[model samples]
Target: MSEPAVSVARYLATTTAEGPGLRTAIWVQGCSIRCAGCFNPHLFPTEGGVRWSPADLAARVLAEPSTGLTLLGGEPFEQAEALAEVARQVRAGGRSVLTFSGFTHAALRRAAAAGRPGVAGLLAATDLLIAGPFRRDRLDHERPWVGSTNQEFVVLDDRFPDLADWRPGALDRVQVDVDRAGTVSVNGWLDTDRLDALLADL
Candidate 1:
């Protein structure tokens, strides 16, 4: 039987920065919360990454000495079905899944409460969901898992159950910047078609 499937801009075999050891990372495509300024704007608009069956990704994670799937993106939450399917593969193979999203924990909860598109299934299978958008000004290199201080690493492991179910409101977006000759400048979210075109051309 094949493993499962996932949507992604690219799936790097391993990354040094995304959590625990020997992690297989999947960078998904697309984003909606285009803050005033954001980095990786290049990946903002793209969606439905290259098709790979669950067995495909799971095989890699299983073959490697890794413990799970570490997800990233333009926004993993947007591609809920793909993510859930990927998570199912990871869990089935006895591996864990760690996901990242732009929506804050509270915001995701609210969306799910209102029956938003992709919130429930995605969160249900995700082991760790790092929430909130990146803020250039609040960027903290010290933080291991997030880009800015406003973003938080939410640990969901049977503790504080129904975390994704409770919501009051949406969370705020943050700024992102690039330094040029000691000058700080902001770059907002990039259009998906443009980004994909550029990558495809390359």
Candidate 2:
């Protein structure tokens, strides 16, 4: 059988913006619950994006010099199986996995209980999970990584020892990357007004 493929929208080798430590961030393509005013509407479509076999993807992510791996979206849960393998391999290499999802933790738990293929595996591989859909109206200025207050940050294991009592006091960081081709990309959390101003200044 052919190895499972993950539709990867974007990949950042190392960054401090996505999670607790310098991490490799993978943004998978396709989101079932496309929330209003989402940061990456371009990633909502299931089609497009570079496809990589689970083993290959895991190898690439592991090659990066980072302390952790962060799974962003187009909804990481949408491609749970392949990504679970990826996360598993990363974790085996002594790295942590942080996953962001539009689905509620309760919903995921139910799915896992129902014996969903990779839901339980993915959850198992994750050290930290940020769950819930984005609510534009519920803008969360206090939290560091999440856009809204409805999102819950759950620490799954003792891997993230420093985060045992983690709060939302830490300031969020956004990064802008300009490749040699002059194409620009932005990641991390930033409010509209400031983001607009920053992009305009760029």
lDDT of 2 by residue, 99-119 (tens): 999999999999999988799
What TM-score goes with each of the models?
A: 0.69, 0.96
What TM-score does candidate 2 get on C-alpha atoms? Answer: 0.96
Q: Model 1: which residue pairs collide?
A: 3-54, 3-55, 4-53, 4-54, 4-55, 5-54, 41-190, 45-192, 46-192, 136-175
- Model 1 alpha-carbon drift over 4 Å, by segment: 1-5, 158-202
How well is each residue in 1-202 modelled by candidate 1, as lDDT tens digits?
Answer: 5433455676666543465444677777678877556655666876556766656666767777666677777787776766676677777777667888888999888888888755786788777788898776776544455567788777765432332322333122222333575553322223335445644554
What are the per-model C-alpha RMSD values against the true structure? 10.2, 1.3
Candidate number of the best lDDT: 2
Clashing pairs in 2: none
lDDT of 2: 0.90
Candidate models: Cα lDDT each: 0.64, 0.90
